[model samples]
Structures are given as structure tokens and as C-alpha cells.
Target: MAETGTAPSVLYEERSQRLLDQVALKETDRTPFVFATRFWAAKYAGITFEEQMYDAEKSAAALEKVLVLLEPDGYVPSLYIFGPTLSALDYRLMQWPGHGTDRNATFQYLDREYMPAKDYDEYLFDPTGYCFRKYLPRVAGAFEGLAGMPDFPSLSEWRFVGAMRAFGRPELRESLRRLLEIGERAEEAAQKSVAFVKRMAALGFPSAGGGFCKAPYDHVSDFLRGSKGCMLDLFRNKDKLLEAIDKVGELLLRGVVEETRAGGTPYVFIPLHWGLDGFMSPQHFQTFYWPGLRKVMLRLIEHDLIPVVLWEGDCTSRLELIGDIPRGKAVYWFEKTDLVRAKSVLGDTVCLRGNVPTSMLIAASPDEVDEYCKMLITKVGKGGGFILDGAASIPDEARTENVLAMAKSVRKYAS
Candidate 1:
């Protein structure tokens, strides 16, 4: 590692500047640190997972405590907010907190055919309409009444007064009540989330990104079709699947354009779920996954937004494919990809973040953690296009001292 022997002295603005500089592949004082703390924030605050999900105040407070203690340059605020909302609706897609699963277990998304193979034509014809009418109602029982609602253009014509009367039914009323309750709780949590982000900023930590997107393949696979269903469609209904993927990609890009017009942060978080090497062969990835995702990345770049692509699984073989992204326009945060090879292939093209083992953070000693981070900084942080972060989110069991070693190594080695 290049050692300057300079004391650690980065204020809020300078810290933020250093992060942006690193993303832009420019020289900076040192590598910036971005930590991903999910359920771990609740544990750090000494609160039960249930309390952290239901209690907005407690959740925000816990996240603030974690950020203050760790002092990372940037962070994702609260991953705990969705549990209560999902629970209230008895959402079948995910099990979390005390609902549909163990009280202490982290959130688990169930893979089932929410949209069966037969519905491909409906989905491709009108993705938004199908989602609201067929998909949402089937996934969440509370939204079943939506299936009876009239189309948007015909609603003003009063063509469905009889359908509107469905809301008066006791069962529908009960569902609406639950929906309102969840909505109110979600809105309150959102307010707390905004306050937490501001507090992190005041404490010298900017947000890693303001919004996030999913790869189009994941957009379909994760929600519409289960892994088995999607894989089958890849063989039986390849043409329809590709068309849907392209449409979804266009829709997501349009949403990004609309959202970023006002200009907040330049970073767009993209947590890729289904495009990993294990999910498909190289040809399938290049065909079904990369095309839509590449278009999304290019669109974001065109709009001057940095696409932060979080590779969620082993992507060693896919690194060169991802390198097609323009240089200095994106950040690729890897989870299980080989870091040394990542630096070798993508080092010159994009700003690379992470590969620190979650196991090390949870099981290793502080010195062991320091040595591992030092190795990453020395090799991966050689040039300026690197940020020190964990391979995945910090688990609830991760040792505090080990987490601190990450920051310590960045300061000692990078400087």
C-alpha cells in the first residue's frame, strides 16, 4: 500500500468530495469507505428485529447510532422499514420479522409464480396495467378488489359504478382498512428515513445513492416469475421473455429520467439479483440479462447519473461483460466475485467497490480484519478507482471491532 503517513483529517464536505472524486476515477486523499448495514443496524442499537421494523423512531435512531460509530463516508439508511408494510398486507412474496417466519430471522423473499407462464401475453401487452390489475391483486389479497376496477380511460366515463361498489363489502372494507394502516405507517417511516439521511449528512456521511433499480431479468424473475418459471420460459417462451425484458428496461429508464430531472444525487443504486453466473450460462446472461441492463446503464449515463451496480452473487466470469460500461461513469460493487481478477479486468474502466467477506466481519479478530482490508487497499486500491466496502451487507452478528478495522485500514494504508 502507498503510505503517506498523513493523519486522518476528512471533514464532511471533503469526505463527500473524495467519494465523488473516487467515483469519477480522479486522484483523491484516500479511498472512500461505504458500508452496507442491513439488519445489523437493529442489533447494534440493542433492539429486537421486530421493534426495528415496526418502530420508525427506533429504526432511524439505531441507524444513526451505527453510522456515528462506524463513520463511513456513505451508507444505506434503513433496510428494516419494509417488514411492517409487508406484514400488514400479509404479503406472500416475502416473510420477515415476526410474520410468516421466525421473529428473529432476516427478511426472506419467497419465490413463487405470482405471474404464471400463461400471463406473458398480458404482461407484455401492458406491463403497468397488468401489474395493477392482475399481478398486485393476486400477490396481495388486500388488492384483489383492484381486479374489478375499471380501466383508467373508462373510469371518467362512469362505466363501472357497480365495480366501485365492491369497496362497500365487509371483506373489501377490512382489506382497505389494513391497507390504510400500512400506508400510514409507511409514510411515517419515510419521514423518519428522510430525517435520518439529513442527520447522516450533518454527521459528515452522505448517502451512497438516492434511488435504486433492478436488472430487468430480476424485475421479471423475482416478482413475476419464480426462478423455475423464468428458467423454463427461457426455453419455451424465449421470444416473449425477451420482448418483456426490453419493455421493462424502457419503462425503468423512463422512470429514472423523470425522477432525476430535478437533480438530487448523481448515483443510482442497481441491486442485481438474477444475472449472476450461477443463474445461467454465459450465452443466456449476454442475451436475456446484459442487453436490458446495459441499456439502463447507458441511459443513466446519458442523463449524467452514475449507475451503482451491486453484483449480488458470484460474477467472476461476468466481469468482462460488465466492463462494457463506459469508463468512470459507474460503480460496480461486487459481492462474491474474485477481487484481484476484478481489479485486473475492470480496474481501468469503472470505480470498483468491495469484496470484504461478511464471514470475516462476523468471525475474525480485529487484526485479521485489518490485514484483509490492507490487502484489498494495497492491490485493489492501487489506482484511484476504488472504494472500500464489505462484500455484502454487514450481518447482525458481525463484530464491532472487525467493522472498525475496515475504516482503520483505509486510513492507515490508503494514506
Candidate 2:
């Protein structure tokens, strides 16, 4: 790998400390640069996305090449789906690696009402049991037999012995065999992910996040109920929906705390999905989205993990609700929200990252990128607690010169 701009001996520590300092609302020598690109890494390494997913070593090498080229202080090393494994299991949530879509197209989630509206009570009563017995079978064809299988506790009951016979059947055995194959392939992909993370850390770019979480409303909307179903639940099944939301929120917080406790890294990535302005009115957002999400943030903060909130869409109207967090305890990465207004509303309470138009990165010249970065750093990076990043992600087709300009500008202006 090419020499990182920071010294090799202290590079990782230096970059990590820079990010931590900004998270703490302390000024650093320069603004820390975080790049969000997944497929672009594959593109940078001159490989198709499918190749990156199947070949662990190749994927790691591709990420390393991108890091060496862009030299961002931090990045997500891998955001790939194990397409072959998912395909093997006949998983229906997403289509990837040209299986059901174009080879060059990014993976698409085939969202549907995986959980029927009628099952709300069942899901609320036992989320784990419902997921295993109800949801999984619907999504993964290999698990269809699982739906008929008795719940584990029922196995101990004398009357349920008949249900146990299903597991011994040839079809169920074949499904189990297919599942094992999927698990093995998933393990391989996970190993590649670990390798890529280690490679990035060794090269001085630490991961921007230590762990991840989803908003409770999104957990219901994206996975269980479809978007339309979730919206309808807000009115039709208000009480049960609220109960389900709280249950999910509790589960999420518990998992995040347990997973992140020993890592020693403070940041947990919380991608805000389906909570933007267009998704719900301000009052509904206040009612359905913010309460559970805020509970999660506060709990994470209590455990000393900084909640890095990636606001995925227009949240301009909900800034006040977000800004309610304790000062310097969160990092808001905005997509379509106005940065200057965000700064005015949230500057004191949280660190801000974001909103460089992806179009600019793909179409603008290097000089143009430089100018835009200058404006962002000068305006938003005025005080401590600002990170420079693309508004969302660096597209696969983003110009290398423009991306480099973003990194170099931080060095030139902010340094």
C-alpha cells in the first residue's frame, strides 16, 4: 500500500483520535474526512460487484486500493451482500449480483409484506418465536418446513410429538442441507469482511462505526410490514403497533449495548430509515418514530457509545426533536437536510457531518469539487464537531479526481 499522508507509526491512532476528538466537540489539527462508498471500491479495483462478493482476498485488495487512492481518514470497508448464499437459500428480500437484476446494478431490496397485518399480535407476543416460526419461512423458501415445526418448548410436551416428525422428513432434511450450505458461504463472506476491516485498520483508516442499529419504526416498516402496511398500522392498529414498536426498541437497545460493550469504540451507527419528513407528518414522526429512536439514543449514550445518526432523507422539520439529545453525544450525518440551518439548530447539541451533492462528485471538475469543499469546511467546519463527507455515498461512477479533491481540500483548508 502507498504511504498514508499521516505517519505510519502513529497513523491509526492519529486518525482515530481525530475522529474521537471531533465527536467530543474538540477542535483537531484538521477536519476528519469520512468517505461512504461501497460499490465504488469494487469499481476502483476494476472488478464487478459479483467478483468482490465471491472472492474475499480480491475484495480486501479492492478496498485497500480504494483507500490508498482516496486516502480518506475513515470509511466502511465492506457493504456487500453474500449474493450466492442468499440466492442458495432462495431468500426473497433482495436481488443481487445480477441474479434478478442487471449485473452492474446495485442490489435492490424486494420489499413486500413479509409479515401480514393480522400477525401483529403474534409478533408482539413473541418477536423471537414469531420471526423463527412465521417470518423466516415466508422469506426463505428453504425454511418453509420450519413454519410447520412446533415451537421448541412444545417439543417437550407429549401432545406435540407428531410435529417433531416433520423434521425427519426428506424434504426438511434437504432444506437443512441447503441451509448448511448457505451458512458456510456466509461464513466465507464474513471472513472476507473481517479481512477487509483489518486491512483498513492496518493502513490507518479506522471504521467510522464500531456497531450498527436500525430505527424501531424502520425495523417494522422495512422488514416485518411493508411501508404501506406500516403506515396503515399507524391508524388501524395503533395500540398493537405502538406495543410492537416499544418491544422492538427494547430489543434493539439491548443488542447494541451487549455487542458494543467490549469493543472500546464509542460510536454506534444508526441508519435512520423511513423517518424522514416525507414518510410522516411532523406530529406522526414525533409520535411513532422519535420516541423509540430517542429512547435508543439515550440508552446508547448512557452506555457511553456515541450514536452516529445517518439521517437518510429530508429531516429539516424534525431537527428540533433530534437536537433534543445531550450536547456532543451524537453525530448527525444528513442527506437532504440543510447544513447551515442544521448547524444553527443543532450545532451546540451535536456534531454534524455532510450534504455534498453526489452529483457534484460524479459530474463536477476537480477545481469545482475543491471550491465546494472550501465552502463546506469554511461554513460548517467553522467550529469543532464537523466531519467532511459526501452527502450520502460516493456513487460507482464518481470521478476519482473529484473524490481526491474532497480529501485534499480537508488537508488544504481545514488543516
Candidate 3:
């Protein structure tokens, strides 16, 4: 790999520290640039999206090309899912390239309600039971047999013998057999992901996020109930839904804390999907979204982990409400929200990242891209806490010259 400053190890340290300093609201020598992307690497490197998912080494090769050319301070890895791993579980949550969409197309999620509103009480009372018996079967075909199994929590002494009979069912036995295959594929995928990160480190590019998580409301609205079901529950099942959110929020926090600790990286990525202005009223956001999200962030901070939140849609109306946090402990990355206004509202409280229009990146001239980046650097990066990135992330169709211009402008103006 070509050296960034002098040597690979030395450059890695410098880049990692630059990101951490920006997170802490400290002025850096220059504003850090993080290339957050998914399929852009594959498209840029002349590989199909299917190749990026099914071939680990090829995906890394594609990502290496981008890192060598752009040399951003850090990057969100371009390859995350392994197709074979999902195939093992017969996962139904998303339809990936070559599976549901065209080989060159990006993965698409199916947003049907996996958990109906009537099951809220059961989930609140025994989430483990609900996941195994109710939730798993709905989302993954591999777990259809699990639906027949009795709740283990109620088993004891003589009751245990009856539970064993449930496992003896042919379908349940087949599910257990399939689980072994899933476990093997999952372990292989985990190792490849670890190796991929290590390879990026050796190339002198630190990953922008160490771990991943989501707000409790998003977890529910996204996976459990569909957006429509969850929204209607606000009026029909308020008490039960609130109870379930707290239970799931605590579980998510514990799991993420453990994962981040094991990964030994300071930044935890939390993508907020349901908290945008178009999703709910301000009162509903205050009641259902921010409190649970704030709890998760505070818990992460207590453990010395920084929560990097991506507000995916326009959240311009909710900026002030979102700023009630300890300064220098988090980052709020915006997708469509006005960055200049965000900087004014949250400049002193948290690190700011992104708002580059993806449309501009895909269609505008390189000079137009450079001008936009210059404006962002001069206005938002005027203060200490800022990092340059795409609005959501680098679009799959973004022009190479436009991205190069973004990277170039950062050094030209911020440095």
C-alpha cells in the first residue's frame, strides 16, 4: 500500500487519532474525511454487487482500490453481508443481489410486520420465548420448525419430559439440523469480516465504526412490527408498546456494549430509521424515540464508547430536541438535514458529519462538487468538531471525479 504520511503503522495511528479528536470536539490539523459506502466500492472497481457479497477477497480488493485512490482518513467497510451466510439461515429479511434483485442491484429489505401488535404482551413478558416461537419463524425459513416448540420457561421436573416430546417432532429436529449448518456458515463469515477489517488497517485506513446498533423504536418499527403497525400501536397499544421498548432497549444496550468491548473500537454506529420528521409528530418522538435512544447513548458513553448516530432522513425540525446530551461524547451524522443549521444548533454539543447531496455526486460536474465541499468546510468545519462524508453515504452511481473532488477539497480548504 502507498504510504499516507511515512509508514503504514504511523499513518494508521495518525488517522485513527484524527477521527477520535474530531469526535471529542477537538480541533484537528484538518477535518477528517470518512468514505461511508456500501456498493460504491464494487461499482467503482468494475465488480458486480453479487461479487461483492459472495466473494470476500474480491470485495476487499474493490475496497482497496477506493482507499488507495481517495485515501480518506477512515472508511465504513463496503462489504458487510456474506451471501452464503444468509443462505444458510434461509434469511427472509432482505433480498440481496442475484437473490431478489439483479446481480448489479443493491440489497433490498422486506418491511412486512414480523411481529403483530397482538403479540406485544407476550414479547414484553418473555422476549426470548417470543423470538424463538413467534419471531424467528416469521423472518427466517430455517426456523419454521421452532414455531412448534413449547415455551421452555414454563418447563420443570415432569414438565420437562413433555417439552422433550415437542423437540422429537420431525420438523423441529430438521430445524435443529439446519441450525448446525447456519452456525458453521456464521463462524466463517465472522472470521472473514474480522480479516477484512485487519486488511483495511494494514492498508492504513481505520474503520469509521467499530460496532452497530439501532434505536429501540427503530428496532421495533423496522423488524418486529412494520412501520404502519408500529405507528398505529401508538394509539391502540401505547402502554404495551412502551413496556416492550424499554425491555428491548435494555437488551440492545447490553448486547452492543459487549460487542463493542470485544471489537475494541470506540465508535458505535446507530442508524436512526424512524425518528425523522416525516415519521412522527414531535410529541410522539419525544415520548417514543428520543428517550430510548438517549438511554442507549448515555450507557455507551458511560462505558467510554462513542455513539455515532446517523439521522437518515430530514430531521431539521428535531435538531434542537436532539441536542440535549453531554458535549464531546457523540457524533450526529445527517442525511438530508441542513448541515449549516445543524452546526449552529449542535456545534458545541457533538461532532457533525455529512450532508453532501448524493444527487450532486452522481450528476454534477467535478467543479460543482468541489464548490459544495468548500462551502461545507468553510461553514460547518469553521469550528472544531466536524468530519466530511456523504449525506447518507456514497451512492452507488456517484461519479469518480466528484468523489475525488470531495476528498481534494477537504485538504485544500480545511488543511
Off by over 4 Å in 1: 1-10, 153-178, 257-263
State the lDDT of candidate 1 residue by residue for 1-415, as single tens digits.
2222323344566777878888888868777788777678888888878788878778888888877777777787654676667766767788777886566668788988889899999888777789767898888877776665446544654556655775676765676777899898787767777777776676667777666677898888888888889998899989989998998888777777656544357788899988888889999999999999999999888988888899988998898788887889899999989888998998889998997898889998999989988888888888788888988867778898888888768778863
Q: Measured by C-alpha RMSD in angstroms, how accurate is candidate 1?
A: 3.3
Q: In candidate 1, which residue pairs get closer than 3 Å at backbone N, Cα or C atoms, i.e. clash?
A: 4-415
Cα misplacement distance, residue 352 of candidate 2 (Å): 1.0
Q: After best superposition, candidate 3 residue 285: deviation in angstroms?
A: 0.8
Better of 1 and 3 by lDDT: 3
TM-score for each of the candidates = 0.92, 0.94, 0.97
Which is the winner by TM-score between candidate 1 and candidate 2? 2
Ranking by lDDT: 3, 2, 1
Give the range of the ten consecutive residues with the poorest summed lDDT in model 3: 1-10
Off by over 4 Å in 2: 1-6, 79-81, 155-163, 261-264
- Model 2 Cα lDDT, one tens digit per residue, 174-290: 778888888898987767676667767776778775778878999899889988899999999888889889999988887688776654467788888889988898888989999
lDDT of 3 by residue, 1-415 (tens): 1244587777888899999998888888888889988799999999899988888888888888898899888988747557887877888999999988899998988888989888888888888988988899988889999988887779898988877898789999899999998888778777877788888898787887687888999999989998889999889999877887898789898778888878757889999998899899999999999999999899899989999999998999999899988999999999999999999999999999997899999999999999999888889988678999999889999999999999888788963
- Judge candidate 1 against the unseen true structure and give its global Cα lDDT, from 0 to 1: 0.80
Q: Please report the candidate that would top TM-score against the real structure.
A: 3
